[model samples]
Target: MSVQAQGREIRILALGDSLVAGYGLARGEGFVAQLEAALRARGIPARVLDGGVSGDTTAGGLARLDWALAETPDAAIVALGGNDGLRAIDPAATYANLDAILTRLAARNIPVLLAGMLAPPNLGAEYGAAFRDAYERLARAHDVVFYPFFLDGVAAEPALNQPDGIHPNARGVAVMVERILPAVERLIEKARS
Candidate 1:
């Protein structure tokens, strides 16, 4: 699964919180596993490492940055900040944490596909605005590929999510994989280049 394998196989790190971890889903039904299977079905062989930790905030991600980077992923899907938003953490702190994470990835020359999340409306408009803006700002600054909202089609869809109404179910993971496949493919190409 190492990136050193070159063109033979691309190893992508799926880093973030519960959604990336496929919380409450069965072993093979998780996002990383589904994404890998989808990539293979598309004739792209890849190893998607599960770097997701439930309830992980951008700060938590920053703390574990070294360990994640140790895997030497060819590229990464940075999906943190959900928990931060959930906890109503200061958006500036969230931005700083994500900024540091992106900087470290860039330093390692690992291309990234950042999966953004919007702040819940319950967090208040000002806080929501700041949180929502952070991802795009960071993506532009870092020149990384970005997916504006991770839960696009799945959000608010009860059938696609677990009872808790946050984490996606297996079917929802499929939809996500389908929607993000193109970006992931582009990420793989970027890594290859």
Candidate 2:
């Protein structure tokens, strides 16, 4: 459906990496589909735009920001940076890209919910520390809402993760939607105001 048609409809752009794209899950099991269902179940009139791209990094997300914002979503859930952590990219760069994205969205008066990602412990203490702090720094600097860790309960859980051990399975996505729904609802409420 077109953005204009969704009058007073809470338009949410789920922008991020494979998790948001539901990489290993079926069409209906993906984040966008499941999030929309969750919102409906909560009696929130909303639409979730699937702006996820498989294997996308924060830098890549920055490059596509203009196109993604074309949907004119009332708010955006920035779920990127997972790929950056996987690739061990410099955390500073990730922060820069995310900061720019948030700045642009703010310029349009669009609220943002920044989804944070943690660097695996195996990535070493130094890298992990920097990477984990990046999200916090950005969120505080921009004064935007932040979810400390996207995979909070799902991350190392065998049952929740897919065979690849990277992306979440269908059940995991459900858990994520439930966990993040409250924050999302708050964002929508703020946007409406």
Candidate 3:
């Protein structure tokens, strides 16, 4: 899709797992749609494509990198690894997958906004630390825009999530899109630059 329309539009790909997919919500309630609406409300024309897949791990995202990029995103929000953490996968492996994804995107001259994910507490402190560290290290190494945690204010709030507790509700998706908007504008700027 075209990145611009009326010289103000941007095409952003929301690439990740369930959170991006809006697991239990209706079509328009997903993160991608909500983010697009939010941007438009803010007078920033944008198209946030649905690149989310429920239950997808970072490895899965890495595998689909080329296809995701085929849409020619002006910028991308990388939100994978949540499923990896939930599955208690090796943090190093997750890191490698994310690193590869970022590397590939960079090679294609695409700007990226890396949204971070925390490992489930039940996985123990060591795993949690490694998981958290991976995002930071990758963001620094790749020099991409970073949002520390994608689920920030809505993670444990039952009122903000669906019955599943993991995936967000419609309202929760709005909150996420709100919180991430500024960073996304910065990402848009990066793409333009």
Measured by lDDT, the strongest candidate is 3
Score candidate 1 by TM-score against the native: 0.95
Clashes of each: 0, 0, 0
lDDT, residue 103, model 3: 96
lDDT of 2 by residue, 78-184 (tens): 99999998998999999899999999999999999999999977899999999989999988988877888888789989899998887999999998988988788
TM for every model, in the order presented, reads 0.95, 0.95, 0.95
Whole-model lDDT per candidate: 0.90, 0.88, 0.91
Q: What is the C-alpha RMSD of each candidate to the true structure, in Å?
A: 3.0, 3.6, 2.7
List model 1 lDDT by residue over 152-190, tens digit each. 899889999999999999999989888988888878888
The parts of candidate 2 lying over 4 Å away from their true place are: 1-7
Question: Is 1 or 3 the stronger prediction by lDDT?
Answer: 3
Off by over 4 Å in 3: 1-6
Please list all clashing residue pairs in model 3, or write none if there are none. Answer: none
lDDT of 3 by residue, 49-72 (tens): 889988899999999989988898
Worst 10 residues of 1 by lDDT: 1-10
Residue 88 alpha-carbon offset, candidate 3, angstroms: 0.7
**Relative to the unseen true structure, what is the Cα RMSD of model 2?**
3.6
Better of 1 and 2 by lDDT: 1
